[model samples]
Target: MNREFIKKLCEETHACVRILEGPIGTNDRIVLISAKEEPDLEISPAMDAFLRVFKHVNDISYGTGGSTDQIAAYFTACSVWLLVASQQAINLIGKQGSSIKSIQESTDATIRVISGA
Candidate 1:
């Protein structure tokens, strides 16, 4: 765990994309460790409780993304919620995805700013 990030609040409004996107600039991939297809009894009292408790995930490996940068990449695994949360995954796809062309357009613009284009 990163001691620096432990105290900081989560500020991600964009839905998380769990598939490994190779790597985020300088860090290794983030993985999902716990939360299985069916969680053990100790993890939850009911299915709904299990769903609610682990709705969001913490990164299991060190991810490389600038906390203060306008646009940065994050490399992490699918939270187990991703497997069960279709609506949530759809929401992320809607926000971060579209046609690849649209994503390319946005990334192109962002790259210009980074490269002083």
Candidate 2:
């Protein structure tokens, strides 16, 4: 829940997004083939780490009902990461477009709730 942790989460999320998008300048069709085979593979580690931290913060936030500011900030950061990750999924997984859209929408809603806007 510190600045350093938030920074690391953003960096990891960016890397996962890039991995989902595949290597640059590759054939789109071939990338699609590989993506179809392992749509959820590359982002698993980053997602796992993010979820662990997120759940920890959520549990603490609920248990204490204090530090609302800090908890809100952490939730906001996590929501941003989820938003970016889901958008990357949508961009990369053509065959699973609808599923990715749902993820993006869900993440967007979470962001709104966390940001109180």
* lDDT, each prediction: 0.32, 0.43
TM-score of 2: 0.27
Give me the runs in candidate 2 sitting further than 4 Å from their true place: 2-43, 60-81, 85-97, 101-117
Lowest lDDT 10-residue stretch of candidate 1: 6-15
TM-scores of all predicted structures: 0.21, 0.27
Q: In model 2, what lDDT does residue 113 have?
A: 16
lDDT of 1 by residue, 1-117 (tens): 342232221221211223243345855544222322334443322332223223323332233232313112333222232232454545434554654346558644321111112
In candidate 1, stretches whose alpha carbon ends up further than 4 angstroms from where it belongs are 8-85, 91-100, 109-117
Error of 2 at 112 (Å): 9.4
